[model samples]
Target: MLSVVIPLYNEARTIVRVLEAVQEAPLPTGIGREVVVVDDGSADGSADVVAAYAASNPALGVRLLRHAHNQGKGAALHTGIAAASGDYIVVQDADLEYDPTDYAKLLQPVLKANADVVYGSRFIGGEPHRILFFWHSIGNKLLTFLSNAFNDLNLTDMETGAKLFRRELLQGLMLREKRFGFEPEVTAKMARIPGVRVYEVGVSYYGRTYAEGKKINWRDGLWALWCIVRYGLFS
Candidate 1:
């Protein structure tokens, strides 16, 4: 079974659609899917929407968890990861930026190629990508470069949210970061695991504009830089 951890906040508009897409996505034969949604204190009716969806679609195996107040994405992920009961875990955002159909592509390395972790990179393949946010793209590349410099891993999209990992391997790590910094911090820690085999695959990206509810900002990039240096060198 694969546990899909979706960390969301104030995504009332896209939450239900993304959940439906996840349920409809086709997985490898004999592989079952379980969705673990962590609502990070969304005030925009996101939690209620998820609850209603769960109640109506009981067969989808959707498990909804909530935080009393808004915590960071990492905190929500921490909660979801701890509650996950699958053999493998994959992080999925409630936003429409990532395509659910690509889950199988990211799982290929772990399922067949024996990868301990797989990253769905938005910068590698011939897959279609919505061209938006020039500065965001530059920042992501810079962060990925800095992270690679410290962790010594050749990842093209270190900030990507679409990551798949062996459940035990992930739950065993001592994670700390909470916000957008979760990306670099986890990557840094994952690289330190002895004999850990990490692979990357191309995935489609349908980025959202600021008016369309994109939440990450320049501050998160700075935090990620600090995380790369702190976790990479000290921890």
Candidate 2:
């Protein structure tokens, strides 16, 4: 079984679509999975959508968690992870930027080869990038480079939304990041542990503009940089 964790913050436009995608995904035989949505104090009607869906489909076990105020992405994910019920866990964004169909590809290594962690690397050799934005792409590459430097592993996309891991192994780590810092924090702690194999699989990513509820801004990039450094050395 896999627990699909989605952190939400005013993602009403895409939350329903994401939920539908997760519901439609064809996980392998005998694979029990759960969709856990964490609402981080979204002022919009995002929570309502999740509740309505869960009410309509009782068998899906669509769990909804709420935060009174706006916490960060990491906090929301932490809540969902604690409530998750599955052997494997995957972090999914509640937006249409990523394809939910790629869950199978992200799980192949972990399920077949007994991998400890699996990341969806957007830069892996596959299809060409559909969007053409140099500065944003460069920033992403730089973050990935710094992450690889500290973790001692070469990866194309370290901050990809799709990350699958062994449920029990991660739950024991006691992660501390509660914001955008979650990415580097996970990489740092995972690096400290031995005998854990982290591999990146090719995946598709669609970049969105600010007009479309794109929350990550220049400030968040700075926070991400700080996270990479702080977690790399101190954490």
Candidate 3:
């Protein structure tokens, strides 16, 4: 089964479309599906969207988790992971950047082959071109390069919000980073674990400008750098 963990905060503009895409997605034949949306204290009507979806599909097992305040993304995701009930868990964003239709592509390595963790790499071979921020791409590549040096695992996209894993892979991992540090923390620590196989596959990416609610700021780049060192050595 698949437990989709979505971190939401003031995403009312795109949550409904994203949720509907998942609802109509063609999941794997035998695996059941559950979508859990974590509301990171959105004053916007994001929770209402999840409620509406849940109201329509009782059998689909949709759940809404609300935070009293705007906790960081990592905290929201960690909460969702603890509550996830499927054998596999996937991190999905409320924005329409990543396509729900491509979920099967991301799940293939874990379900059919030899990977405990899989990331949808925007820079990989089969991915379609995406309009990107020049500095953002440069920053992402530099951080990923540093992560590769630290973890000794070559990865293309360090901060892609698309990550899938077997629930067992994350056993006992108390995630520390609350925000943008989440990705590097997971990748760094995950690379050190024994018998864990990680892979990256090409996936579609549709980036948005600031006016479109793209919230990652220039300062988050500093946090990513800290995560590469902090999780690699301290953790």
Candidate 4:
């Protein structure tokens, strides 16, 4: 089974659409999917929306978890990960920025090469990508470069949201990030693991602008830099 951990915030507007997309997305043959949606105390009724969807679509295997208050995306992820009952795990956002159909692409490495980890990069494939912010793209590349320099990796998108991991390997890690810094922290820590086979595949990105409900900002990028250094160099 592939456990899709969706750490949702106050995204009531897109949560239901995201859920439906996940349910309709294609997966590898013989593989089952379970959605573990961890609501991070959304005040916008995102949790209620998810509950309604789950109740209506019981065959989707939707499991809703709550945090009581907004604890951050990483915190929600931790909660969802703990409750996941699958052989493989992947994080999905509540927003419509990422395509759930890419799960098959991300899983190919695991099916063929026994990859322990697979990161879906947005900058390497012929897939369609929405043209959005220029500086944001630069910032992402800079962070990925710095992260590679520290971790001795060559990832094109270290901060990608579409990452797949073996459940046992992911659960064994001591992830400490509780916010947007989760990307860099996890990448650094995953690189340090001995004999871990990490692969990267290209995935499409439908980036949103601030006016369109994008949440990340320059401050988060700075925090990501600090995280790359802190986790990659220190621990």
Q: Between which residue pairs do clashes occur in model 3?
A: none
TM-score for candidate 4, please give it: 0.98
Which pairs of residues collide in candidate 1? none
How much does each candidate deviate from the true structure in C-alpha RMSD?
0.7, 1.3, 1.2, 0.8
Candidate 4 lDDT over 1-235, as tens digits, reads 9999999999999998898899899998999999999999999999999999889988878999999899788899889889998999999988988999999999999999999999999999988889998999899999999999999999999999999999998888899989999899888888888999999999998988899888888999999999998998887
Task: Give the residue spans of candidate 3 off by over 4 A.
Answer: none
lDDT of 2 at 51: 96
- The order by descending TM-score is 1, 4, 3, 2
Q: Tell how far residue 183 is off in model 2, in angstroms.
A: 0.9
Q: Write one digit per residue (lDDT tens) for candidate 3, span 1-235.
A: 8888999999998998888888787777787788989999889888988898788878867899999999888889988998998888889899988887778888888767868899998888677657768989899999999998988888889788889888877755767889989999999888888878898888888888899899899899998998898887777
> For candidate 1, lDDT tens digit of each residue in 145-209?
99999999999999998999999999999888889888988898899999999999999999999
Kindly give the stretch of ten consecutive residues in candidate 4 with the minimal lDDT sum: 52-61
lDDT (0 to 1) per candidate: 0.93, 0.86, 0.86, 0.92
- Give candidate 4 misplaced runs (Cα > 4 Å): none
**Lowest-scoring 10 consecutive residues by lDDT in candidate 2?**
125-134
TM-score of each: 0.98, 0.96, 0.96, 0.98
